[model samples]
Target: MKRLTLIAAAVAAAAAMHAPLAPAADKPVSIGKLERVATFDGAMPTGVTVTETGRIFVNFPRWGDDVPYTVAELRDGKAVPYPDAAVNVADPADPAKGFISVQSVVADGRGRVWILDTAAPEFKAPRRGGAKLVAVDLASNRIVKTVVFPAEVVLPSTYVNDMRFDFRAGAEGVAYVTDSSLSGPGAIIVLDLATGKAVRRLNGHPATMPEPGFAAAIDGKPLPATFKVASDGIALSPDGDTLYFCALSSRRLYSVPTRLLRDPNVTEAELARAVRDLGVKGASDGLESDAAGAVYAGDYEHNAIRKLARGSTTWRTIARGENLSWPDTLSVGPDGYLYVIANQLHRQAGFNDGRDLRRKPYELLRVKVNAQPAPTN
Candidate 1:
């Protein structure tokens, strides 16, 4: 009878100890406030950029969705066709003339917005005249220049993912592009704004390629083995000295000197040696920098946004929420906020056994960061 009483008392003590701590441990401690700026009920949006005047622009890649226009400007709570509706229409014969599956849009801070068109809808082989970079004048709202990539630079498997501009580089400026190809190796393409000349750098480098056998766990479930993505996120430092990038399937971050990348005399071997692994920053899809020198990234695995502050190697979470599902892109707005897009990419049919588990109304959210966009000019 005494032994039975002791067992009951021990059980009661164990239950009392477990009950209070479990609930508190499981609850997430949210940091910064996540403010919803817009909600997408139709197509899933990937990239977002904000101009100095606070004009919000977003892009919708041709990934099986019924995207009316590839790029739109969010004005008065509507995704209005940017610049005009005519340029948004794609012409198969003259793919370079129109926006064919634009992947990213960036405001140059020099009174222009650059649009990167992949020209490879549904991740298919790019059309000859399709892959191009276009610049539009914000004041005139007209396309000022269109620089099409050479057939050699844009390979059949190349998917031009994201880009950043450095107006301080050369005569007119320079743009860095990421080729996040899934079927082939990944690379960075450096484009001279003056001559429209482009060259591939660090092609097939392990830093740019997807981590072998890497699988991201989303919602406590591991991504399928078939899922793989290469160097998808790219950003530039405030002074345009270092270029930071990371692969989609990897947690590691890397950077190289901008001068070495811009040097035409630098060989691929020399450039590869210059690459620096900056340690793991969680699984990120989009990366951005601010004038304060902080590098921001979307922590999709944790449903949060993290930042590597200037001079700090340790990453710190700035914001977190349940609605931050698959935070696909990050943009530092001029209004001192870090904007992000939560598109729920893992719930798509491609990742979920051909059954789309995505619910409607993906989100565009922002958190106060008290920083300005990195200056390019």
Candidate 2:
């Protein structure tokens, strides 16, 4: 499993792979506490999600490294792969059927773990075999069902990066994903959980891509934004009123009503109109929304987290540069702590001078939310 190599490539220029935006702050976000988590030392951990039992699962996106336990179940403060990995009992060396690169790991309303694998070898060209969304029973830690994306919807250039689940969609569940394609315009792909059908709408909404001229300072040096779809962080407001998102390259955050984003019949033109710019919230790598209606953003600029209060008009820098290292992602742990993946991405060879300057155990820090974490799905 080449999770490290894949991330070094997938997340590179990701801040702008969707859309490049203007720069805002040069200071690092202060979020406090920098400690290494065991799981991240070997793989370039890109995504993390916690279950109801306080068990944590982190995934590596097919980065170029041998990942013995790329997708693990963290217990007793230690990380272990969920179930004993056996070669596809169906076929051994094919590797295609095995647990490949999971770009995102999400815990849904039912407390189920959904691992999204871009499946493509190195995520180089989006292929069908590598495009699957797996539902795992956390209690048993085994894959139950694997939903494959339709080939037409799975563009060869697509990098299905991050995802959000809407269980109420059509009485079953729906998954909204961002295809931050590195080689072309980005798009938002929607999947129907029941029918196994998927749709690609707003294929190139300006709001879904990066803002032009968007530049960010990583490692004290200027790095151009690589605006693509995946870098555009998407999160649901606690009240579920809106879906907050922004391009990693841009300093601002924008959102459209969740009602519109999930409307299967909503026209692209309407989606274009539904987009509401939330203005700049500094620089960030990922976005997550809780049930309290506040949208939490991991400010990569200041190494802290920022929030947009429910119904508020301005962005607030609630947490900043507090021992955070290039905060890579933002999500709520089942224990109600805001979990962060500080991958120190920019320090890697992609942005730096051919080096893996990230600290060992790459930190996974969490802070208690204002209240109990809300379940978006």
Candidate 3:
């Protein structure tokens, strides 16, 4: 896939591309073990979602992997294009016309799978129609609707990473997306589902940007400075009142009132005032909220998942181990199990001196939990 070559050329910041390896921790933390659900011998999978009926779906970004399909349905322990292979094929001339690079696939409780298309393969500049939100009818396996962001909304440097849906927000629903742009400012993108209007909020806010002195380490070595990823993970409280977010390179968690974030009238200054820094919770890549208001965070550096309960000042590790390599995105399935993607992203080619270091048989694992998807429409 030439992803390493593409990323190196895309960043063009040689200074930020190389770094020294840090020392590994002496002992590994022990929590709970993850049960293997499916394995991918090809491309590394990131996002995972299980429908109320126990339908499992996953996505693979064109991050240098030979992904036959960007989004797939896991059936009989294999990944098959959900809707069809044609939808997964991108139009070379116009990548936005089809799925170019998919970063996340979310199954809202309302029986629909929402795919967040970054549209910028190899982390290149985003095209006008490249960044979009596509909703597929789970029952019919057909695309029901699409929402494309305008250039002004999804800037060239924007890398739409993850999203959460609040079906109760607007007439149809509302979506909160994170722009984890490595080379530009990071912010939250809000979408009014009924109108298909997208707005950028907290643009370049301190909370959304990568921590100044923080860098994620893998195999006892820190990633290049250019590997800074900001505002990559997001989650919603059970009551739809609070929205939690974190930077891929950060250890602290932050939150703001959904009401303030949804209110266009709330000025940026006001929204900043509403944001609360919830202290450190380990360097994380993804966050998921359960019906009980507990937020599950993926601690990438420690190969663990931590749970932060309502009103808690500290995070408690729920799962951890060497097998949980680079715990990427997390989903609380309808079957009351936490599904996680251990794609070994830190072991990818980009971080391994331009040599693909990802091992075979990427895993989709689940651990039994007393959690359910947060209520949606």
Q: Which predicted model would earn the best lDDT?
A: 1
Ranking by TM-score: 1, 3, 2
Model 3 lDDT, full chain set: 0.85
Each model's C-alpha lDDT? 0.87, 0.68, 0.85
Candidate 3 structure quality by residue, lDDT tens digits, 1-23:
69998786556433212211233
Candidate 2: tens digits of C-alpha lDDT, residues 302-350: 5667667787866655554535767766777656677888777766666
Model 2 misplaced stretches (Cα beyond 4 Å) = 1-39, 87-96, 224-231
Residue 289 accuracy (lDDT) in model 2: 80
Model 2 lDDT at residue 258: 69
Q: Over all chains combined, what TM-score does candidate 3 have?
A: 0.92
> Which should have the higher lDDT, number 1 or number 2?
1
User: Could you tell me the lDDT of residue 230 within candidate 1?
Assistant: 85
TM-score of each: 0.92, 0.85, 0.92
Instruction: Give the alpha carbon lDDT tens digit for every residue of 1-377 in model 1.
Output: 99999898777544432222111212234567899999889889998999988988999999899998999989887788988899999986788899989999999998888999999889999888789999999999999999998777899999999999998988999999999998888989999988888988888899999987677777677887777888999999999999999999888899999999989898889999999999878888999999989999887777777888999977877787778888887888888999998999989998887999999898899999999999997
Model 2 residue 229 distance off true place after TM-score fit, in angstroms: 6.1
Local error of candidate 3 at residue 129 (angstroms)? 0.8
Worst 10 residues of 1 by lDDT: 17-26
